[model samples]
Target chain A: QQQVKQSPQSLIVQKGGISIINCAYENTAFDYFPWYQQFPGKGPALLIAIRPDVSEKKEGRFTISFNKSAKQFSLHIMDSQPGDSATYFCAASMEASYDKVIFGPGTSLSVIP
Target chain B: DAGITQSPRHKVTETGTPVTLRCHQTENHRYMYWYRQDPGHGLRLIHYSYGVKDTDKGEVSDGYSVSRSKTEDFLLTLESATSSQTSVYFCAISRVTRGEQYFGPGTRLTVT
Candidate 1:
């Protein structure tokens, strides 16, 4: 069984547009949610994260809107740029065992210049 | 890459052969993990070590084994390789169990 599920295996957006990706989880034990950005031939890097305590978290043009009650979360990229084109993964982990993160399939985003 | 290096970034081995992938860290972190990345599967944890001589299995540990003799090194070995095991492997490090982790570039293994 997949602990976390992500939608829209791929997406395309024009420059200066808003790009959205969604994720849902079945495990309530997960308290930490993180998004990672990966480029070809490189390891994934942490993009943004959020906790259940807050409904929304933003950093620069990237934002994570979390809905604890709905067991869902989504990533938003405002003013999307070509550099933001990459594979994004949504992950969840229990606070006690954070290293054992459960990841969603992934979303491949392409931002047109 | 969080001072982490994985040896034999790309390797091709015949079935029934044994293969070992090494993950070394200079960050001296307390946690090291071995994971496999496959298409449509995202990443699945194979094993993790909390400290030297301390380790535990993750979600997918059936065909793999791990060893952490020193704080800086974590090794994953496949006693008998199989085509089903062909995938990209990644090593990650974290200072604490619930903290953020840094991943290595990855090792692409092909079993023919």
Candidate 2:
């Protein structure tokens, strides 16, 4: 079973537009949610993370809006740029374990210039 | 990015052969993980080590085996390679308490 489910296997957005990707989970035990970005031929890098206590977290043009009760979360990249084109993955983890993280399938986002 | 390196960044082998991939960490983190990334699937954990000589299997460990003799190195081995095992493998290290795992560049393995 996919503990965390992500939608829109692929997406395309023009530059300066708002790009959105959504994710939902079935495990309420997950307390930490993180988004990772990966480029071709490279490993994934941490983009942003949010805790259950906060409804939304933003860093620069990237934002993560989390809904604890809904067991859902979404990633928003504002003013999207071509450089932002990459595969984005959403992951969930609970502190109860010693850092065991479960990742979502991933969303391929393409930002047009 | 943490100081993590995956040896033999790329490898190709025939079916029924044995292949081993190594993950080394300079960060000296207590926890290390081995994961596989495929085209349509997210990264799936093959195995993980909490400390030297202490390891555990992850969700997908059927065709793989792992070992950690020291805190700095973790190894994943495929007893008998198969075409289905061809994929990109990644290693990550982290401090258990922090829950922030750092990943390595990754290794591309092909089993023909």
* Cα lDDT of model 1 by residue, A24-51, tens digit: 9988888889999999888888889899
Q: Candidate 1: TM-score?
A: 0.97
Compute the DockQ of candidate 2.
0.64
As a whole number from 0 to 100, the lDDT of residue A55 in candidate 2 is: 99
Q: Which ten residues in a row have the lowest lDDT in candidate 2 chain A?
A: A93-102
Off by over 4 Å in 1: B97-99
Provide i-RMS per model in Å: 1.8, 1.6
Q: Which stretches of candidate 2 lie over 4 Å from their true place?
A: B96-99
For candidate 1, give the lDDT of residue B49.
Answer: 91
DockQ for every model comes to 0.62, 0.64
Q: Is the docking of candidate 1 incorrect, acceptable, medium or high quality?
A: medium
lDDT by residue (tens digit), candidate 1, B1-112: 5899999899999999999999999989988999899888888999999899999999989889999999999999999999999999999997653536689999999999
lDDT string for model 2 (B43-95, tens) is 99899888899989888999899999988999999999999999999999876
